[model samples]
Target chain A: MMPGSLRAACVAVLRRDLLLAWRRRGDIALPVLYALIVTTLFPFALGPNDDLLARVAGGVVLVTVLLAMLLAFDALFRPDLEDGSLEQLMLAPQPLALLLGMKILAHWVSTALPLIVIAPILASMLHLPAHANAVLVLALLVATPLLSLLGSVLVALTAGTRRSGMLLALMLLPLCVPVVIFAAGAVSAAQEGLPWIAPIAWLGAALALMLILAPLACAAALRIAIDA
Target chain B: MTAENSPSALLAARDLTFLRQDEPVFGPLDFALRAGEVVLVEGDNGSGKTTLMRVVVGLLHADEGTLYLDGAPLDRDLARGRLLFLAHHLGLKADLSPLENLRIAIGLYGCREAITPQQALHTVGLQGYEHEPVRQLSAGQKKRSALARLLLVPADIWLLDEPFANLDREGIALVNRLIERHVAEGGAAMVTSHGAVTFLHGEPRRLRLSA
Candidate 1:
């Protein structure tokens, strides 16, 4: 196949996924709603102490977003696997890793983009300091794609199994630890008026590394799942 | 069409074997498919007909075998643009309309020339139902929607598993016509069915698998 055609294939997969997500916009809203509800419940469960809520707000938002993102992960490859589009993907002339990268990008656009946009509302709802909001969103911007990218590999591994939600979470949660730590740590530092760019930069670095490796791993895992 | 008599294989398998749970599914089998020819694979349940197609499409790796495409060792990425595999699942996204599904399928496989999704849908007898979501289509229509890929995409080899399964008489005839035109144009196909159906064109070779 021509190089131009390969690039066209990637764009086609990306557009197709985005169009599908747009058609099912209700499903896309669930994760954002979950983030909002969970973030709102924090202050109620811990009493109305602003200091206490604000102190833990960074960690709370990170954990909530992570959990919300996990909800979408179960769906990343399930629809394709069930309908056999995954088999077509494997057989495409384009490199599987390149094709999977487009899919991960689409997943982030559909699921994680909304969470990042609304995260500050949730953060402020939890009484998180106003100054830390930008850093929180920035951290989320970097970390959420990391979550989608890393989570996709696990999702691909479990795509063929029935009831793979719990298995996907089990496989993915451990891998998300560093991203959560760095993102939450950045927000907490910003809350304390410290220079927070270092941790956020570290998160970016990790994301860059994941960008290079996650798609390849996910593609390999998809092949295994299909062959099983 | 002259390549049909050229004595060269378009697709060839040497000592192909696949195992599930360490037991052989089908193995040590050798076959060659030439241009403008059809090979019908027959087998009983669990006899590995589907597995063989899966292996041929590179969805599953043969445990021990060599596969060649057009006289060269098979490199899936290089050979992919030349092949299309239609399995039992149909590969349609239920939420998407037939037009959208065909567009995506054609785009992914990289069409040889500009062919509108509408034209492909029309050819597949889905003209009136182009915008209906696949879930709303009857089983035969869904299969036809998937079959639109054969008309829209440029591929020389087609691997179909139970292509006649869910189709009514007319739908079955549609598949046979597609196969006939494809082989007549020098494309090759391998189809698996429980029993044989009359081909409208070239003589179809048969390969039977034993459990």
Candidate 2:
């Protein structure tokens, strides 16, 4: 934990980030909508069989949430880095790790929080088994922040590049595989009436690992982005 | 911690070199800035005026050489605490109100004894416009809003790249006063600008870079 002053600064950044997401509603809302629409389309694209839907629902919700997280990743720091807010942020006395954490925190609140709240509803639309749906939302609540935190680093890495969004997806999609596998696996295991604890524990561990390392990576990448 | 009472250069750089996109930007250079002194970095576009400041401020490390702040070797985090950088881009969050921006900035910097929003706004000549989103402000007004952070935080060194490029006469005057006030408070500043600013209390030594 940082001193109160630095913590306050991080909180300030988090607040501003959340407020901006509120003001632009569409930036964050669109991704949640994308997740919902994509999840809903699975039944139509495949078939109306409840048994098939139950088996596929976990993967559908997990994949859609992953895509939704990526969609909003661009908003993390590129604008601030390009427009000079990054320089101000770098110049501030607060540690870059803490400052980056604040942005990641903000991103989770706006993007992941909504996804968690809405995952249950989307799961029902997919005809997911009730037990599996609970596991799906729970896994997401634990896993989505990991995606945002790690994805933010990749976003920072490609910050000033010509094809940043494409580059970010290329770099990040691979790293996100574990999260997808573990989170979706948890729900799938629940659907099969197997204990889902192993995958859930893995997801929790991955989230903790990401929480520790992602801020440092994002801060270093931000320095590169600004220099470039 | 390096004691302030010791006779030392607040900022010192030796043979600093920076490379951008495989092209040498500036340096293999040396310089020092002491308390209350001002240093002027002069160069045309793409000549690395911004790059040099970035390196000095420890946002970008030099390809060669070493930097020192307050008699200690400069690290990114330590240097960040000692220096303030204002870049050519205004860095304003267009969607955020001016007060929101300043308060957020102060928060991000972890400035204790940070000024109230009213004081920061008044200092930047933005008194009545605190609640308006920065995007709604004019170019000069936006710049002022960006600069409002200076009043909210206490920094030992100021690195400004083109502090007056897009300002009106009044804005320029305001910038001058701000710089003068910063110096009066025993702080040092390094800046790059297009032309002479007559209002700086002391003549800053000029260093020019050629592409």
Share of reference contacts found in each model: 0.67, 0.71
Q: Per-model TM-score of chain A alone?
A: 0.96, 0.94
Q: How many clashing pairs per prediction, in order?
A: 0, 1
How does model 2 fare in lDDT?
0.79
Q: Which stretches of candidate 2 lie over 4 Å from their true place?
A: A1-4, B1-8, B110-115, B195-202
Model 2 over residues A130-193: C-alpha lDDT tens digits?
Answer: 8888888889988888888888888888877765667777898789888888888888889889
Question: What DockQ does model 1 achieve?
Answer: 0.61
lDDT at residue A61 of model 2 (Cα atoms)? 81
Relative to the true structure, candidate 1 reaches a TM of 0.95
The per-model DockQ list reads 0.61, 0.56
DockQ score for candidate 2: 0.56
Candidate 1 residue pairs in clash (backbone atoms < 3 Å): none
Candidate 2 clash pair list: A9-B107
Per-residue accuracy of model 2 over B1-211 as CA lDDT, tens digit each: 2332235678887778998776789977777787877888877777888889877877676888888777677776566666778887877889988988877766665443645768878988898999998888998899998788777666778888788877888888888888888888898888786544434445776677766
Instruction: Give the lowest summed-lDDT range of ten residues in model 1 chain B.
Output: B1-10
